[model samples]
Target chain A: MTELTRIIELFQLPFMQRALLGGILTGLMGGMLGSFTILRQLSFFSDALGHSALLGISIGLLIGINPSVVLLPFAVCFALGVTYLLERTRLWTDALLNIIYSSSLAIAVIVLSFVGQYKGGLNNLLFGDILAVRELDLVFSGLLLIACTVFIGLTLRTQMLLTLHEPLAIARGVSVSAQRTAFIVLLSLVVGISIKAIGVLLVSAFVVIPACAARLLSRTFTNYVVLSAGLGALSAVAGMLISAAFNLPSGPSIVATQLVIFLTTMALPQLRALGHG
Target chain B: MREIVLSVEQLTVYRETYAAVQDVSFSLESGIDTAIVGPNGAGKSTLVQAILGILPRQSGDVFILGQPLSCRGSLAPAIRQQIAYLPQNFLFDRRIPMTVEELVGLGWDKLGFQLPWKDHRKRRHAIREALVRVDAAHLMHKMISGLSGGETKRVLLAYCLVRPRRLLILDEAPAGLDVRGESEFYQLLYQLKREQGWAILQISHDLDMVRRHCDRVICLNRTLLCQGTPEVALSSDNLSAAYGSEFVRYRHRH
Candidate 1:
């Protein structure tokens, strides 16, 4: 098939449309929140949350509930627990996250061992099969994207301040701890929601790399977020197209595309310097 | 009317049963410059945090501008709005992505909502004026990441001055300063005290400087051993009480 014919064929499928929409929404939310994750050094927290999604789903399956339905609250409460531990204890953030990641992985493995019939569904969740995207998933992803944008708009500046100096933020009359908790909760929501599209194994790749790439390209914080979200959305949708044509896994395919974007962005600075010289 | 800008009764803090500060009580009158002088780990910073409602007080009551603090994590913004705090700049990560202008503006309680564009001239004038007073005007546009230890403190000092609060708390400020820098810092504080009539609370180890500049001295070590005029509070006997048996006997020239 020629390029035009292939493009026409790809857009004709309803599942393809849903998958592309879900991927785009997931990418946008992941990108925007990922900027904060990288800036505040919460990549480990996000990664831990991503991994814990499997445990949440597995537990849901064990209790005979739809995993997707239970994933949101489970992820949020888990993130809050992580946040509390990070605050109440003197343990380093990464170390705490590592403990959560490993224990969550173990729990997931243990739970999956007993889940006989729902194994295929769990596999689809563990490694996202975006080709099976439903209309409900598209709706949920769209709502999350809107929610994430509104949240970022409302709390972005204060969040930046809180991230910079918690003590100072407190002294400034900002509810430092509350804002911190709210931030981790938002990260949890993004991580939890994106798990269905990006998968447990590589969700953080979407949330972290895009922001880092944007950081190298951005001179201002505003530009950092804008570029991050834009790059993320672009990669997510484009990678879904590639996945469709080549029968690749949507999650890893999108992650690989972001890596390529980051590399290209990293090289742009050098290319510009060379041009100047 | 009560002139006390801040009052603390039996303020105590503990770290896993180790009392970092215990039964500390004092009150500050408006426009009085009080110095809290102690050795390292003497709970000076703890007391400052308690007053600011930053630390969880194990036991105590704190009143700021006649409003009692409930030790419920942190006080409301309206309460903190009446105060300007210059905490230990050494604790802040210099790499935080902020400019001096942005940081100094953050001192205002309402600046969080206002665009810097709308408040730029008024805020800039105030920030620059404060920066000019502290001799940090050249760093107005500089990223916080690039500042030296002394420069960061100066910038923080400007932040404290940007808004005219009724009370000012300086905790271990000017830590990386030389004697000359220390002299300049106190002089500026003294000037601000005279001009603004805001109660000034200084947490430091510079006894001589406090003696020369502050109206009162609080010699603290987990508890309030003594609080009075610098001449009396800095006395050897009171110094022994505050610093414990191993306290050094610095010769008082006066």
Candidate 2:
């Protein structure tokens, strides 16, 4: 079979099909929420949440529960704690996120050392094994996607206003605190679900890269959001196909694909300018 | 008779441990334009933030249209919604792709948890009317990120005008504009105040503008130093007390 046909054949397998579905769902969720994350300058916060997932996974391994299940609540609480500190303590955002990111990572490493036969399991989570994605994982991703979609769809305008100018949004009575907390909660959930398909190391790339690409190409906010979702899904599928074709690691391949898209977007304006010149 | 629209009583706000504004009290009535004047660090912005409940006040009571908007450290949202505020700086990420029309639409009076089922035509008309009122109708379709400083101010003013407000508070709304631009902006604001009977409260540094357009002035230097008609409040003695030796040089320069 030709290379393209061979890649298609790989995707025809049931396990590959599951992996593709999980990736697409994760991509959609990440892309939609990532726009807000990027706009609110919460990219570092999202990265910290992703890194902190390792602690959740390590704890689950210690307790003999599925890491994925444990990660959901762990991430939610982590995000809420960070949000509370940010609101109450008034520390600079980067300072707090950096402290959380580094500390969580250190604790996770120490915990992982205690986990017997941890090498294989840790590698799978850090780099991801899309072929190992189970049906239950896909279901969780689907439900989370729906929850995010409904919440974002219902509050798009108000969320947009808040993202653009928070003080004005507050003055206009947009329930800024409640909406922000809801957003952070949804983001943590997305990070938890996404860590399975994208891996802890590359998950933020999955979340932020497509949105950055979309911003480079979009002319309006609505266009930016829709394009972000589109680019995310497109990158995930393309990355999976590349992974299958090259027999490469799925998570890093997906992130690499997203970077390629971002670079292409960054270069488009220049290319157009060159053409005009 | 014009009713009192905003009342701030014994308002005290602190930054860290020091009182930034102390025992400041003022009331604004409909059809009267009021200005707050003070030197730098006199708690002009802090007073506004405290009254708007953006900042936690040490002790204060802020009422709008007879309803308590804030008491001590707590703010009532329903009461605060009645007042429109134009902050000194309209801060946002420049890369955001919002349009002037979209920005103004965010100020629509009916913004709530319900789906936006309001009449689209009426909403569009209101947005257009607000932009036109600010001489920014031509900018409705333009991206907010691409707007110039003056255009941004006009668009923000249009945002405040999109909804009915019991009181309008502007925090140095004309700070960066040229002398002509400042005069014209104040003129437009005065016209809006006259037409809508808006209780206008603004923070300003231009003594000339305060003397010309404001019905009353409140001078501050950590505490209320003066509050009266511009003639009394902007008197040399009161100016000296609020601004210290700096005002004498500033007054002589003008």
Find the candidate with the highest DockQ and give its number.
Answer: 2
- For candidate 1, give the lDDT of residue B175: 76
TM-score, cand. 2? 0.93
Alpha-carbon local distance difference test for all models: 0.79, 0.84
Model 2 DockQ vs. reference: 0.45
B168: Cα error in model 2, Å: 1.0
Candidate 1's C-alpha runs over 4 A off are A88-90, A117-123, A241-247, B109-138, B244-254
Q: Evaluate chain B of model 2: give its TM-score.
A: 0.93
CAPRI grade of model 1: acceptable
Displacement of residue A261 (Cα, Å) in model 2 is 1.4
